[model samples]
Target: MTVALMWEARAVTGRGEELLAWARAQELTPGPMRRETFRAPQDRVLVITWWDADYDAVLPELPDPGGELVSRAAHRWRFEPVPDPT
Candidate 1:
C-alpha cells in the first residue's frame, strides 16, 4: 500500500513566502515517490508526499522551519488510499 504524508504550516505575518521557499528546499531522507506543494490564504503552506509504504510505516517528516518563520508549530497527517475494487 502507498501512504500519503501531509505537512502544513502557518507562517508569521509577512513571512509566507520565506516559509514556502524553505519548505520547497527541504530534502527528506528516503525520498517519497512524488511531492506537491500548495499555498493558501492566511499565510498557510501545505505539502503532500506520496510514498510506497504501509500506512503504519515510519517515514521521515519535514523538519521545523524555525520560530522565525512561523507563528506556531507545524501540523502533519498520514493517509492511506482506499483499496480499489474491480
Candidate 2:
C-alpha cells in the first residue's frame, strides 16, 4: 500500500544552512515527498512529509536521519490512514 510519512524534528542552530545544502544534494535522488520549515516559537524547526510505495520502505532509515539529531528530538505526532466518513 502507498503510505505517507510525515515527520518533524528539531534542527541544530547555525547548521540549518548546512542541512539545507545536504538536502539539496539528496534532491537528485527520487524519494523525499515534501519538506517544510517553520518556527517553533523561538526555535527553528523543519518538518517533512514523504510518501513511499510501501510503509516498510521508509521505516528502516528513519532513525538514521531522525533519531540521530545533534542533540535529541521528539516526534510530536504521527498519522496513518483513516476511513472516509460517509
**Highest lDDT: which candidate?**
1
lDDT score at residue 6, model 2, on the 0-100 scale: 48
lDDT (CA) per prediction = 0.94, 0.45
Overall local distance difference test of candidate 2:
0.45
Tens digit of per-residue lDDT, candidate 2, span 1-86: 44555444454655555444443343424555554544453233444555555655634223324433333553544445568999
Pairs in clash, predicted candidate 2: none
Residue pairs with clashing backbones, model 1: none
TM-score per candidate: 0.93, 0.45
Q: How much is the lDDT of residue 7 in candidate 2?
A: 40
Report model 2's TM-score to 2 decimal places.
Answer: 0.45
Model 2: residues with Cα > 4 Å off, grouped in runs:
12-28, 59-70, 73-78
